[model samples]
Target: MSRTKKDDKPAGWRKAEIIEAAAQCFMERGYHATTVDDVATRLNATKGRIYHHYATKTDLFFDVHRTGMDRLFSAIRPVHDRGGPARERLVAMLLAHARAMLEHHTYETVVAQGVQVHRFDQTTEGQRQTMRDLIATRDTLEQLFKSTLEDAIAEGTLAARDVSIAVKVLLGGLQWSIFWYRPQPGETEADRVALAEKMVAPLVAGLRAAD
Candidate 1:
Protein backbone atom coordinates (compact mmCIF):
# COMPACT_ATOMS: atom_id res chain seq x y z
CA MET A 1 0.00 0.00 0.00
CA SER A 2 3.02 2.28 0.41
CA ARG A 3 3.94 4.14 -2.75
CA THR A 4 6.20 7.10 -3.11
CA LYS A 5 5.46 9.63 -5.86
CA LYS A 6 8.12 7.94 -7.98
CA ASP A 7 6.69 4.47 -7.37
CA ASP A 8 3.04 5.30 -7.36
CA LYS A 9 0.50 2.96 -9.00
CA PRO A 10 -3.19 3.38 -9.53
CA ALA A 11 -5.72 2.46 -6.83
CA GLY A 12 -6.89 -0.40 -9.07
CA TRP A 13 -3.44 -1.97 -8.96
CA ARG A 14 -3.30 -1.77 -5.18
CA LYS A 15 -6.76 -3.25 -4.88
CA ALA A 16 -5.80 -6.13 -7.17
CA GLU A 17 -2.79 -6.82 -4.98
CA ILE A 18 -5.00 -6.99 -1.92
CA ILE A 19 -7.46 -9.31 -3.67
CA GLU A 20 -4.68 -11.66 -4.74
CA ALA A 21 -3.38 -11.75 -1.18
CA ALA A 22 -6.82 -12.42 0.18
CA ALA A 23 -7.24 -15.24 -2.31
CA GLN A 24 -4.08 -16.89 -1.09
CA CYS A 25 -5.20 -16.61 2.52
CA PHE A 26 -8.62 -17.97 1.66
CA MET A 27 -7.10 -20.82 -0.32
CA GLU A 28 -4.81 -21.81 2.50
CA ARG A 29 -7.06 -21.25 5.51
CA GLY A 30 -10.61 -21.41 4.13
CA TYR A 31 -12.84 -18.33 4.37
CA HIS A 32 -14.06 -18.96 7.87
CA ALA A 33 -10.53 -19.34 9.22
CA THR A 34 -8.98 -16.51 7.22
CA THR A 35 -8.87 -13.05 8.78
CA VAL A 36 -8.26 -9.59 7.39
CA ASP A 37 -5.03 -9.66 9.40
CA ASP A 38 -4.07 -12.86 7.61
CA VAL A 39 -4.46 -11.17 4.25
CA ALA A 40 -2.59 -8.09 5.55
CA THR A 41 0.27 -10.20 6.82
CA ARG A 42 0.42 -12.06 3.53
CA LEU A 43 0.95 -8.73 1.81
CA ASN A 44 3.23 -7.42 4.55
CA ALA A 45 0.79 -4.56 5.03
CA THR A 46 -1.35 -3.39 7.93
CA LYS A 47 -5.05 -4.00 8.54
CA GLY A 48 -5.61 -0.34 7.72
CA ARG A 49 -4.23 -0.97 4.26
CA ILE A 50 -6.88 -3.58 3.51
CA TYR A 51 -9.65 -1.67 5.29
CA HIS A 52 -8.74 1.38 3.22
CA HIS A 53 -9.85 -0.48 0.12
CA TYR A 54 -12.48 -2.76 1.67
CA ALA A 55 -14.77 -1.97 4.57
CA THR A 56 -15.32 -5.62 5.44
CA LYS A 57 -13.78 -9.04 4.85
CA THR A 58 -16.93 -10.02 2.96
CA ASP A 59 -16.35 -7.14 0.55
CA LEU A 60 -12.82 -8.28 -0.14
CA PHE A 61 -13.94 -11.89 -0.48
CA PHE A 62 -16.58 -10.95 -3.03
CA ASP A 63 -14.01 -9.04 -5.05
CA VAL A 64 -11.95 -12.20 -5.26
CA HIS A 65 -15.03 -14.08 -6.42
CA ARG A 66 -15.72 -11.44 -9.06
CA THR A 67 -12.13 -11.50 -10.24
CA GLY A 68 -12.14 -15.28 -10.55
CA MET A 69 -15.25 -15.22 -12.71
CA ASP A 70 -13.75 -12.45 -14.80
CA ARG A 71 -10.63 -14.52 -15.30
CA LEU A 72 -12.60 -17.59 -16.46
CA PHE A 73 -14.54 -15.61 -19.03
CA SER A 74 -11.41 -13.92 -20.32
CA ALA A 75 -9.39 -17.11 -20.60
CA ILE A 76 -11.99 -19.13 -22.50
CA ARG A 77 -13.88 -16.52 -24.50
CA PRO A 78 -11.27 -16.34 -27.25
CA VAL A 79 -11.33 -20.07 -27.72
CA HIS A 80 -15.09 -20.05 -27.65
CA ASP A 81 -15.24 -17.26 -30.23
CA ARG A 82 -12.78 -18.69 -32.68
CA GLY A 83 -14.34 -20.30 -35.74
CA GLY A 84 -13.58 -24.00 -35.76
CA PRO A 85 -15.14 -27.43 -35.70
CA ALA A 86 -17.40 -27.55 -32.69
CA ARG A 87 -15.70 -30.55 -31.18
CA GLU A 88 -12.30 -28.99 -31.62
CA ARG A 89 -13.48 -25.71 -30.16
CA LEU A 90 -14.93 -27.54 -27.21
CA VAL A 91 -11.63 -29.30 -26.61
CA ALA A 92 -9.71 -26.02 -26.78
CA MET A 93 -12.11 -24.34 -24.38
CA LEU A 94 -11.75 -27.17 -21.91
CA LEU A 95 -7.98 -26.88 -22.10
CA ALA A 96 -8.18 -23.16 -21.60
CA HIS A 97 -10.42 -23.70 -18.60
CA ALA A 98 -8.19 -26.36 -17.05
CA ARG A 99 -5.11 -24.23 -17.57
CA ALA A 100 -6.80 -21.24 -16.02
CA MET A 101 -7.75 -23.36 -13.05
CA LEU A 102 -4.13 -24.40 -12.60
CA GLU A 103 -2.65 -21.01 -13.40
CA HIS A 104 -5.06 -19.06 -11.23
CA HIS A 105 -5.15 -21.79 -8.63
CA THR A 106 -5.70 -19.62 -5.58
CA TYR A 107 -8.39 -17.45 -7.12
CA GLU A 108 -10.20 -20.46 -8.60
CA THR A 109 -10.07 -22.37 -5.31
CA VAL A 110 -11.34 -19.43 -3.30
CA VAL A 111 -14.11 -18.80 -5.82
CA ALA A 112 -15.08 -22.46 -5.69
CA GLN A 113 -15.29 -22.27 -1.92
CA GLY A 114 -17.28 -19.06 -2.18
CA VAL A 115 -19.87 -20.88 -4.27
CA GLN A 116 -20.24 -23.51 -1.57
CA VAL A 117 -20.74 -20.76 1.01
CA HIS A 118 -24.11 -19.90 -0.54
CA ARG A 119 -25.60 -23.17 0.69
CA PHE A 120 -24.61 -22.44 4.30
CA ASP A 121 -26.50 -19.12 4.59
CA GLN A 122 -23.23 -17.41 5.31
CA THR A 123 -23.76 -14.04 3.62
CA THR A 124 -25.79 -11.18 5.07
CA GLU A 125 -28.89 -9.84 3.30
CA GLY A 126 -26.88 -7.04 1.61
CA GLN A 127 -24.15 -9.50 0.62
CA ARG A 128 -26.64 -11.98 -0.80
CA GLN A 129 -27.40 -9.65 -3.70
CA THR A 130 -23.74 -9.50 -4.60
CA MET A 131 -23.64 -13.27 -4.27
CA ARG A 132 -26.56 -13.50 -6.66
CA ASP A 133 -24.71 -11.33 -9.17
CA LEU A 134 -21.69 -13.61 -8.87
CA ILE A 135 -23.91 -16.61 -9.44
CA ALA A 136 -25.20 -15.00 -12.62
CA THR A 137 -21.65 -14.58 -13.87
CA ARG A 138 -20.95 -18.20 -13.01
CA ASP A 139 -24.06 -19.24 -14.91
CA THR A 140 -22.91 -17.30 -17.94
CA LEU A 141 -19.67 -19.23 -17.89
CA GLU A 142 -21.61 -22.49 -17.79
CA GLN A 143 -23.81 -21.35 -20.65
CA LEU A 144 -20.75 -20.73 -22.79
CA PHE A 145 -19.84 -24.36 -22.41
CA LYS A 146 -23.39 -25.59 -22.82
CA SER A 147 -23.95 -23.75 -26.07
CA THR A 148 -20.73 -25.08 -27.50
CA LEU A 149 -21.67 -28.60 -26.48
CA GLU A 150 -25.04 -28.19 -28.13
CA ASP A 151 -23.33 -27.09 -31.33
CA ALA A 152 -21.03 -30.09 -31.22
CA ILE A 153 -23.96 -32.41 -30.73
CA ALA A 154 -25.80 -30.87 -33.67
CA GLU A 155 -22.69 -31.13 -35.80
CA GLY A 156 -22.36 -34.81 -34.86
CA THR A 157 -19.02 -34.12 -33.24
CA LEU A 158 -20.14 -35.01 -29.75
CA ALA A 159 -22.72 -37.29 -28.20
CA ALA A 160 -25.05 -36.40 -25.40
CA ARG A 161 -28.73 -37.10 -24.95
CA ASP A 162 -28.86 -34.38 -22.33
CA VAL A 163 -26.69 -31.32 -23.01
CA SER A 164 -27.30 -29.83 -19.59
CA ILE A 165 -26.23 -32.95 -17.75
CA ALA A 166 -23.25 -33.35 -20.09
CA VAL A 167 -22.09 -29.81 -19.47
CA LYS A 168 -22.27 -30.34 -15.72
CA VAL A 169 -20.26 -33.53 -15.96
CA LEU A 170 -17.65 -31.91 -18.18
CA LEU A 171 -17.24 -28.82 -16.00
CA GLY A 172 -17.42 -30.85 -12.84
CA GLY A 173 -14.43 -32.86 -14.04
CA LEU A 174 -12.39 -29.69 -14.51
CA GLN A 175 -13.60 -28.04 -11.29
CA TRP A 176 -12.82 -31.03 -9.10
CA SER A 177 -9.15 -30.10 -9.48
CA ILE A 178 -9.68 -27.03 -7.29
CA PHE A 179 -10.34 -29.36 -4.41
CA TRP A 180 -7.31 -31.62 -4.83
CA TYR A 181 -4.70 -30.15 -7.18
CA ARG A 182 -1.43 -29.32 -5.45
CA PRO A 183 1.35 -27.87 -7.52
CA GLN A 184 4.57 -29.72 -7.22
CA PRO A 185 7.87 -27.98 -6.49
CA GLY A 186 9.62 -26.47 -9.50
CA GLU A 187 6.70 -27.12 -11.84
CA THR A 188 6.75 -25.02 -15.00
CA GLU A 189 3.87 -23.62 -17.03
CA ALA A 190 4.57 -26.32 -19.59
CA ASP A 191 4.33 -28.90 -16.82
CA ARG A 192 0.94 -27.59 -15.87
CA VAL A 193 -0.13 -27.57 -19.53
CA ALA A 194 0.94 -31.18 -19.92
CA LEU A 195 -0.96 -32.10 -16.79
CA ALA A 196 -4.03 -30.27 -18.06
CA GLU A 197 -3.88 -32.12 -21.35
CA LYS A 198 -3.70 -35.38 -19.48
CA MET A 199 -6.63 -34.39 -17.35
CA VAL A 200 -8.72 -33.17 -20.29
CA ALA A 201 -8.14 -36.12 -22.67
CA PRO A 202 -10.40 -38.60 -20.93
CA LEU A 203 -13.14 -36.07 -20.48
CA VAL A 204 -13.09 -35.28 -24.18
CA ALA A 205 -12.93 -38.92 -25.16
CA GLY A 206 -15.94 -39.72 -23.09
CA LEU A 207 -18.02 -37.15 -24.96
CA ARG A 208 -16.80 -37.76 -28.50
CA ALA A 209 -19.47 -38.86 -31.00
CA ALA A 210 -19.34 -42.44 -32.16
CA ASP A 211 -17.73 -43.05 -35.51
Candidate 2:
Protein backbone atom coordinates (compact mmCIF):
# COMPACT_ATOMS: atom_id res chain seq x y z
CA MET A 1 0.00 0.00 0.00
CA SER A 2 1.06 3.55 -0.67
CA ARG A 3 2.11 5.33 2.52
CA THR A 4 2.58 8.56 0.62
CA LYS A 5 -0.46 10.49 -0.58
CA LYS A 6 -1.18 14.18 -1.08
CA ASP A 7 -3.51 14.21 1.92
CA ASP A 8 -1.54 11.84 4.13
CA LYS A 9 -1.29 14.62 6.67
CA PRO A 10 -0.26 18.08 5.45
CA ALA A 11 2.10 19.84 3.13
CA GLY A 12 5.14 19.30 5.36
CA TRP A 13 4.33 15.63 5.70
CA ARG A 14 4.05 15.25 1.96
CA LYS A 15 7.35 17.01 1.43
CA ALA A 16 9.03 14.66 3.90
CA GLU A 17 7.62 11.68 2.08
CA ILE A 18 9.23 12.95 -1.12
CA ILE A 19 12.57 13.60 0.57
CA GLU A 20 12.70 10.11 2.05
CA ALA A 21 11.74 8.48 -1.22
CA ALA A 22 14.33 10.56 -3.02
CA ALA A 23 17.01 9.53 -0.53
CA GLN A 24 16.38 5.85 -1.18
CA CYS A 25 16.33 6.41 -4.90
CA PHE A 26 19.56 8.35 -4.85
CA MET A 27 21.20 5.75 -2.69
CA GLU A 28 20.28 3.02 -5.12
CA ARG A 29 20.90 4.80 -8.43
CA GLY A 30 23.49 7.43 -7.60
CA TYR A 31 22.65 11.11 -7.74
CA HIS A 32 23.58 11.66 -11.39
CA ALA A 33 21.43 8.76 -12.51
CA THR A 34 18.33 9.66 -10.50
CA THR A 35 15.62 12.04 -11.73
CA VAL A 36 12.68 13.88 -10.24
CA ASP A 37 10.59 11.29 -12.04
CA ASP A 38 12.39 8.49 -10.18
CA VAL A 39 11.63 10.14 -6.87
CA ALA A 40 8.00 10.60 -7.91
CA THR A 41 7.71 6.98 -8.91
CA ARG A 42 9.03 5.89 -5.54
CA LEU A 43 6.19 7.80 -3.88
CA ASN A 44 3.70 6.50 -6.44
CA ALA A 45 3.22 10.09 -7.47
CA THR A 46 3.98 12.00 -10.65
CA LYS A 47 6.66 14.39 -11.79
CA GLY A 48 4.31 17.28 -11.12
CA ARG A 49 3.84 16.17 -7.53
CA ILE A 50 7.58 15.94 -6.81
CA TYR A 51 8.31 19.19 -8.62
CA HIS A 52 5.65 20.88 -6.51
CA HIS A 53 7.65 20.15 -3.37
CA TYR A 54 11.18 20.29 -4.80
CA ALA A 55 12.17 22.70 -7.52
CA THR A 56 14.92 20.32 -8.67
CA LYS A 57 16.50 16.99 -7.90
CA THR A 58 19.34 18.80 -6.16
CA ASP A 59 16.86 20.41 -3.82
CA LEU A 60 15.48 17.00 -2.88
CA PHE A 61 18.99 15.60 -2.45
CA PHE A 62 19.97 18.36 -0.05
CA ASP A 63 16.79 17.84 1.94
CA VAL A 64 17.56 14.13 2.15
CA HIS A 65 21.06 14.85 3.49
CA ARG A 66 19.71 17.47 5.88
CA THR A 67 17.04 15.13 7.20
CA GLY A 68 19.63 12.43 7.86
CA MET A 69 21.83 14.84 9.78
CA ASP A 70 18.88 16.18 11.74
CA ARG A 71 17.88 12.67 12.72
CA LEU A 72 21.35 11.69 13.97
CA PHE A 73 21.77 15.03 15.73
CA SER A 74 18.46 14.55 17.53
CA ALA A 75 18.90 10.86 18.27
CA ILE A 76 22.31 11.29 19.88
CA ARG A 77 21.60 14.55 21.70
CA PRO A 78 20.61 12.93 24.99
CA VAL A 79 23.74 10.80 25.15
CA HIS A 80 25.89 13.71 23.99
CA ASP A 81 24.52 15.98 26.71
CA ARG A 82 24.61 13.60 29.67
CA GLY A 83 27.66 13.89 31.85
CA GLY A 84 29.52 10.66 32.38
CA PRO A 85 32.89 9.00 32.03
CA ALA A 86 34.22 9.37 28.52
CA ARG A 87 34.41 5.65 27.95
CA GLU A 88 30.81 5.16 29.01
CA ARG A 89 29.43 8.21 27.30
CA LEU A 90 31.32 7.85 24.05
CA VAL A 91 30.29 4.24 23.71
CA ALA A 92 26.67 5.21 24.30
CA MET A 93 26.90 7.91 21.66
CA LEU A 94 28.49 5.56 19.15
CA LEU A 95 25.83 2.90 19.65
CA ALA A 96 23.08 5.46 19.26
CA HIS A 97 24.65 6.61 16.00
CA ALA A 98 24.92 3.09 14.70
CA ARG A 99 21.31 2.41 15.56
CA ALA A 100 20.15 5.53 13.77
CA MET A 101 22.05 4.47 10.66
CA LEU A 102 20.41 1.08 10.72
CA GLU A 103 16.95 2.48 11.39
CA HIS A 104 17.20 5.18 8.73
CA HIS A 105 19.23 3.02 6.38
CA THR A 106 18.67 4.84 3.10
CA TYR A 107 18.95 8.43 4.28
CA GLU A 108 21.97 7.78 6.43
CA THR A 109 23.70 5.85 3.65
CA VAL A 110 23.25 8.78 1.27
CA VAL A 111 24.49 11.14 3.98
CA ALA A 112 27.51 8.95 4.52
CA GLN A 113 28.53 9.77 0.98
CA GLY A 114 28.47 13.54 1.39
CA VAL A 115 32.02 14.10 0.22
CA GLN A 116 31.36 12.61 -3.20
CA VAL A 117 27.99 14.32 -3.47
CA HIS A 118 29.52 17.72 -2.77
CA ARG A 119 31.77 17.36 -5.77
CA PHE A 120 28.80 17.46 -8.12
CA ASP A 121 28.40 21.20 -8.65
CA GLN A 122 27.90 24.55 -7.03
CA THR A 123 24.49 25.87 -5.98
CA THR A 124 22.82 29.22 -5.43
CA GLU A 125 23.75 31.22 -2.30
CA GLY A 126 20.55 30.11 -0.59
CA GLN A 127 21.25 26.46 -1.21
CA ARG A 128 24.86 27.01 -0.21
CA GLN A 129 23.62 28.39 3.12
CA THR A 130 21.52 25.30 3.66
CA MET A 131 24.61 23.13 3.14
CA ARG A 132 26.48 25.31 5.60
CA ASP A 133 23.81 24.75 8.23
CA LEU A 134 24.04 21.00 7.73
CA ILE A 135 27.83 21.17 7.90
CA ALA A 136 27.57 23.03 11.21
CA THR A 137 25.41 20.31 12.65
CA ARG A 138 27.96 17.70 11.56
CA ASP A 139 30.81 19.73 13.02
CA THR A 140 28.96 20.05 16.30
CA LEU A 141 28.58 16.30 16.52
CA GLU A 142 32.26 15.74 15.76
CA GLN A 143 33.22 18.33 18.37
CA LEU A 144 31.31 16.37 20.97
CA PHE A 145 33.46 13.34 20.26
CA LYS A 146 36.68 15.36 20.30
CA SER A 147 35.73 16.94 23.64
CA THR A 148 34.96 13.58 25.16
CA LEU A 149 38.27 12.23 23.91
CA GLU A 150 40.06 15.10 25.62
CA ASP A 151 38.04 14.50 28.75
CA ALA A 152 39.06 10.86 28.76
CA ILE A 153 42.73 11.76 28.45
CA ALA A 154 42.46 14.28 31.29
CA GLU A 155 40.77 11.73 33.55
CA GLY A 156 43.21 8.89 32.71
CA THR A 157 40.52 6.75 31.12
CA LEU A 158 41.40 6.48 27.46
CA ALA A 159 44.61 7.59 25.80
CA ALA A 160 45.02 8.65 22.23
CA ARG A 161 48.12 9.83 20.43
CA ASP A 162 46.09 12.51 18.68
CA VAL A 163 42.63 13.36 19.88
CA SER A 164 41.49 14.94 16.61
CA ILE A 165 42.57 11.92 14.61
CA ALA A 166 40.95 9.67 17.18
CA VAL A 167 37.65 11.47 16.76
CA LYS A 168 37.73 10.86 13.01
CA VAL A 169 38.68 7.23 13.44
CA LEU A 170 35.95 6.62 15.98
CA LEU A 171 33.38 8.40 13.85
CA GLY A 172 34.50 6.56 10.76
CA GLY A 173 34.00 3.31 12.58
CA LEU A 174 30.40 4.16 13.35
CA GLN A 175 29.77 5.34 9.81
CA TRP A 176 31.10 2.04 8.54
CA SER A 177 27.68 0.67 9.48
CA ILE A 178 26.20 2.61 6.58
CA PHE A 179 28.12 0.55 4.03
CA TRP A 180 28.17 -2.91 5.56
CA TYR A 181 25.39 -3.51 8.05
CA ARG A 182 22.25 -5.35 7.03
CA PRO A 183 19.90 -7.42 9.10
CA GLN A 184 20.65 -11.10 8.90
CA PRO A 185 17.76 -13.43 8.32
CA GLY A 186 15.64 -13.80 11.46
CA GLU A 187 17.41 -10.94 13.19
CA THR A 188 15.42 -8.85 15.64
CA GLU A 189 15.95 -5.41 17.14
CA ALA A 190 17.17 -7.20 20.24
CA ASP A 191 19.77 -8.84 18.02
CA ARG A 192 20.93 -5.49 16.64
CA VAL A 193 21.08 -4.16 20.20
CA ALA A 194 23.36 -7.04 21.06
CA LEU A 195 25.45 -6.35 17.98
CA ALA A 196 25.90 -2.75 19.05
CA GLU A 197 27.00 -3.90 22.48
CA LYS A 198 29.48 -6.36 21.07
CA MET A 199 30.79 -3.83 18.57
CA VAL A 200 31.44 -1.16 21.18
CA ALA A 201 33.25 -3.55 23.52
CA PRO A 202 36.27 -3.77 21.22
CA LEU A 203 36.07 -0.04 20.58
CA VAL A 204 36.37 0.81 24.28
CA ALA A 205 38.94 -1.90 24.82
CA GLY A 206 41.15 -0.40 22.16
CA LEU A 207 40.82 3.06 23.67
CA ARG A 208 41.63 1.99 27.22
CA ALA A 209 44.41 3.87 29.00
CA ALA A 210 47.69 2.03 28.79
CA ASP A 211 48.13 -0.57 31.52
Best by TM-score: 1
Q: Tens digits of per-residue lDDT for model 2 on 94-154? A: 8887777777778888886665666666788887787778788889988988888788788
Residue 12, model 1: lDDT of 86
Q: What does the lDDT come to for candidate 2?
A: 0.80
* Alpha-carbon shift of residue 202 in model 2 (angstroms): 2.0
Residue 22's lDDT within candidate 1 is: 93
Model 1's TM-score against the true structure: 0.91
Off by over 4 Å in 2: 1-8, 184-186, 207-211
Best by lDDT: 1
Model 1: per-residue lDDT, tens digit, 40-159? Answer: 999888999899989889889999999998999999999999968998999999999999998888889989888667776566888999999999998889898999998998999776
User: What lDDT is reached at residue 100 by model 1?
Assistant: 91
**What CA RMSD would you report for each candidate?**
2.5, 3.0
Residue 109 Cα positional deviation in candidate 2, in Å, after optimal superposition: 0.8
